[model samples]
Target: MIVIRTPGRLSVRLQPRVLAVGTVCLLLTLAVGVLAVGHGEYPMSPTDVLRTLTGGGSPAEEFIVTQLRLPRLATGLAVGTALGLAGAVFQSLVRNPLGSPDVLGFTQGSATGALVVVAVGGGSAVLAGAAALGGIVTGLLIYLIAWRRGVHGYRLVLVGIGVSAILTGVNGYLMTRVPLMSASRAMLWLTGSLDGRGWSDAVPLLAALAVLMPALLACAPALRMTELGDDAASGLGVRVQRTRMLLLAGAVLLVALSAAAAGPVPFVALTAPHLARRLTRSPGVTLLPAAVIGALITVLADQVALRALPGQLPVGVVTGVIGGGYLVWLLATERRAGRL
Candidate 1:
């Protein structure tokens, strides 16, 4: 008797479950965003929000929903997804759950770039492009410097931290040198405000994500192999350096897109992958799931921030409160385990 083993494509076989979860998360995000649209001082109902979105509401309501809230909601979702996907990619490539754009300074680089553009009186679109370029440049520089034969996760983290500190100083100096009014506006952007965001702001973010996410997803198989130790991966015919470079580039692109959209909303990129890994109980971070979780967290957080207080709070503030607390807890736990 002869025995045969069947080979299967794990990723494709899991596609249905992945698709189901993604669809559910997307619907939930839409529902939350819709409800949030109706929630400010003017207060439209969900039906009103839908009617406004679909061109059936009163002009005033339409303006509020379509012009004001819609963009904010869309930006929140787009930024969240970008950060989440970036976080997942970084965490997987580095084989460390803590490897995220925010943690590693890519966000700071993007922020610095955007700040320079804003300080120089550039338009918002230009500012976004500048931010993306900054993030990519900084990420590539760090990767190149950290590449000792190949990339090491620890070296990357160290270089990133240094880069972050340097950029932060530059950002502060730029803010201080600018005229008061311009500085004030730049500060708002720095703090990640959704105020006055219209369809215009939403357009670029959505477009970037549309173009970038597919490319990142296509890199997933290589990402998985690279997560196996470099030696093991190389033995299995993976071109470790080339694959890692590609992965790093994809991660940087996603991160830059996110930072440009939302002014480097802190901690989302740092925390979302860990949260996704924990939630799915997966051995490693998966990009698609992480993006979904990131979108949900931000969309819901924005909803809470909008209505939780007597006045509107910046969505970043909401994420900061939760993410900061989690970071503290994580540190404490690591210390207790003698791992910090």
Candidate 2:
């Protein structure tokens, strides 16, 4: 362990393995992002993509990269980063493998909100707003229901599961009641694609992360302490409930932003933290590594959906398939270990 300090103002303790994992994940995310940019009908070379990004390419390359692919790539990066940070915070706080945005129904809330807009013929423009509102509302509802004097991990997880199931039903009912065209649009949104995305869709999410990520990072010590249990954490001078509330608020907003931007792209939130933890073999919260892995996973899944398949499948479909397999493997592994 090496400690870097700027006199009395700042100090950072670094773990070699964790640092290495985060570095690798960051590099992989950039590589996948480049591949995504260079891909599609135009198909620029990596050299062309890099050169164009640096402002030294042909007009056509400039237009294609700047106008077409960059916005989508930027959106995917932000969404992934948000989900990863949210997942790391939630999973660490709840101490449950099942504690994720999708499992907790925040994503479902976003879908419900978007479907409501479409059902009322509000069109695509306001769908992001509606989705964000839904997620925020759902998060609040779950938090309220889970609070009994103070929130417990098991109680929070149970409340989330129940709320998620109810929201799933509500989403299905709304889907059935909508018009055929609206239903089709809702289906696509629910599947979470980056299709037809531009700067407008990317900015709000990026802005939300810009505001939220730093606050969450500042709370990282308390977050890791809370994982040691509330009693112990409180004894250590951590305001356990306050920490929980702040973390919950940040996680919810992150989820809302990602859902609004990308329609709740799956598995990235659930898998990123775990993958980061496994890679680093770290017992503490792996926020930076998780965020990097989340970006890599989302971007890579999107690239697969766009380029590796015959008919461009939705990014969510690719993630769902991968996450499902991973989920099953996870369940079996837990069962055999008698932890399930």
Candidate 3:
């Protein structure tokens, strides 16, 4: 661990292996991103894709690469990175592998918010704002309800599961109330597609990630200390409750913004951190590696969604199928190990 300290400010300890793993994941993410941009219906070669990106291509190539593909790529990367970071925070805080925004009702809450906006004939901006509000509200509610002497991970998880079930029902009811055309639009968004996404959709998520990433990184040491138990964390000059609240709030915002940008793209959050931890062989959650892996998974999944299927499918459908299977496998493995 290499510790960097500026007196009275946050100190971060860097692990060499974690940095190596993050670098590898980022390289893989770039490779996948290239494949995603180059292998679409227009079928630009990697060289052509690079040329277009570097402003050296023809008008048609520019339109295809810059206008059509780049925005979608940007949104996918941002959303994936946000989800991955949020998932790492939650999983670490709860000290449970299953802790994630989707599992903890945050995503469903955002979906519910967006669905309500759709039902009321709101525009995209309104929908995004409402989604963020809904997620933040739901997170606060869950935290309050889960609090006794303090928030316990198991209690929070249980409460979140119940809240998720309720929100799922709410989403279903809202769907039924909307007109067919509106319902179709809502359903498509809810299923989470990168289809037709432009810079308008991508920009806000990028901005949010830009601000939140550093804040989370600055808090990383405190977060890691919290894993040693509240008493130990407090003994080490960490304010446990305050740190938990801040981290939880940060995680919720990341999920809300990502959901707003991409519709609750499932399983990225739940899968990315665990995969990162395994890849790094890290005892603690590896945030940067998780973010990179999340980006890679999302970009590759979008490629498959657009090209591999007979008809273009929503990106969420592909992720949902894979994530659901992973969820089942996780349960089975945990049960076998007597960890459930």
Candidate that scores best on TM-score:
2
Per-model TM values vs. the true structure: 0.85, 0.94, 0.89
Cα error, residue 76 of model 1, in Å, equals 0.9
Better of 2 and 3 by TM-score: 2
> Going through the candidates in order, what is the number of backbone clashes in each?
0, 0, 0
Best by lDDT: 2
How far residue 301's Cα lies from its native spot in candidate 3, in Å, is 0.7
Q: Candidate 3, residues 78-154: lDDT per residue as tens digits?
A: 98899889999999989899899978999889989999999988988899888888898999999999988888778
Candidate 1: where are CA atoms >4 Å away? Answer: 1-11, 15-24, 51-63, 324-340
Error of 1 at 312 (Å): 2.3
TM-score of 2: 0.94
Candidate models: Cα lDDT each = 0.77, 0.87, 0.85
Ranking by lDDT: 2, 3, 1
Encode model 2's per-residue lDDT on 43-137: one tens digit a residue: 98898899999999999999999889999999989988998899999898898876899888788888889988988888566999999999999
- Enumerate residue pairs that collide in model 1: none
lDDT of 2: 0.87
The clash number for model 2 is 0
| Deviation in Å, model 1, residue 250 alpha carbon | 1.8
